[model samples]
Target: MGARRGFQEAVLAIVKKIPPGKTLSYKDVAGRAGNPHAYRAVGSILNRYDAKKWHIPCHRVVRSDLPAPRPGLYFVYAVLCGNGAIYIGQTGNLQKRWMQHRNGTASDYTRRYGARQLFHYEQHGSREEAVQREKWLKTGFGRKWLKREWKAGRTRQAGGTPGGYRWGSKRKLHLLKKEGAL
Candidate 1:
């Protein structure tokens, strides 16, 4: 009974720690609660979260990799978008990186892109592999890469207004007239 109470308290604390545009998977929550191997149990706990869509972002949790669990993946995707998590990048120490973003020490890219956490993550081997995968995701798809691959919903617009002192066609004509070239 005492142990069960402790778990409940842990769950509530973790949920509270989740920021406005961030998330944590069942696996991540469970692991942080000192269970490391309780993804299924964590999911069960989340499934019964009475607060549901209000207090907890139950939809952000997702199954890792392809051939996902269909409805579950779609649900997670929706939550990610709602939470402003427009991109998905991986790091060797997934948990550590998650902490960095949550604590406001996020990467330049994440800062510029307005991305946030929205679910848990599954381990995908070594850190090198994860870095390589991130690089590939950023490059292989280009614009599609940012959208389909990285899940970047927001974009930095390409060009801004020209400065008041740029050499344009009119400027070139004026210069030629001054030099007697036209």
Candidate 2:
């Protein structure tokens, strides 16, 4: 515990030196603390400390990779939570966003609802299209349509196809491959 506490103190000291409007990645902080591989530990330390009291800018320590939306095919995806509720969201990187949800860092809704798996997705040419689709999916008519489609596909009979998916116990590829879906 002494060594661990030393590392935490080192992280806070490093963060305290970050210039205003500047940032350092978690990896950078860990490396400065004499442990290149303890990046996650740096993040943990930052999250556990109070920046105001410590006079440390903990928020300046961020992930090595920024969250700028990648330019590519955007998607409006749905996750079927363990609670039998659906979550609608739009993202440029579906896989990364899905991972965040799976890790319970994506949103309070997913974390609270226990997001189970990717229920559905629709690819779009532009961000606007994905945003529009996501907005529509949150409406009464859109939700009804998703339910109707899910019922038609009979996805309750679980087991993944080819793409990695799991809804409830598992998810089906055939349902995802259906027209107008992903």
Considering summed lDDT, which 10 consecutive residues are worst modelled in model 1?
Answer: 156-165
| Residue-wise C-alpha lDDT for candidate 2, range 53-168, written one tens digit per residue | 76765544444332334677887887888578998898897656765665467899877765555767777889999999899989999999988988798433221122222221
Per-prediction TM-score to the true structure, in the order listed? 0.42, 0.48
* Range of the 10 consecutive residues with the lowest summed lDDT in candidate 2: 160-169
> What does the lDDT come to for candidate 1?
0.45
Could you give candidate 1's per-residue lDDT for residues 42-66 as a string of tens digits? 6566556655344654433433222
* Prediction 2 TM-score vs. true: 0.48
lDDT of 2 at 74: 89
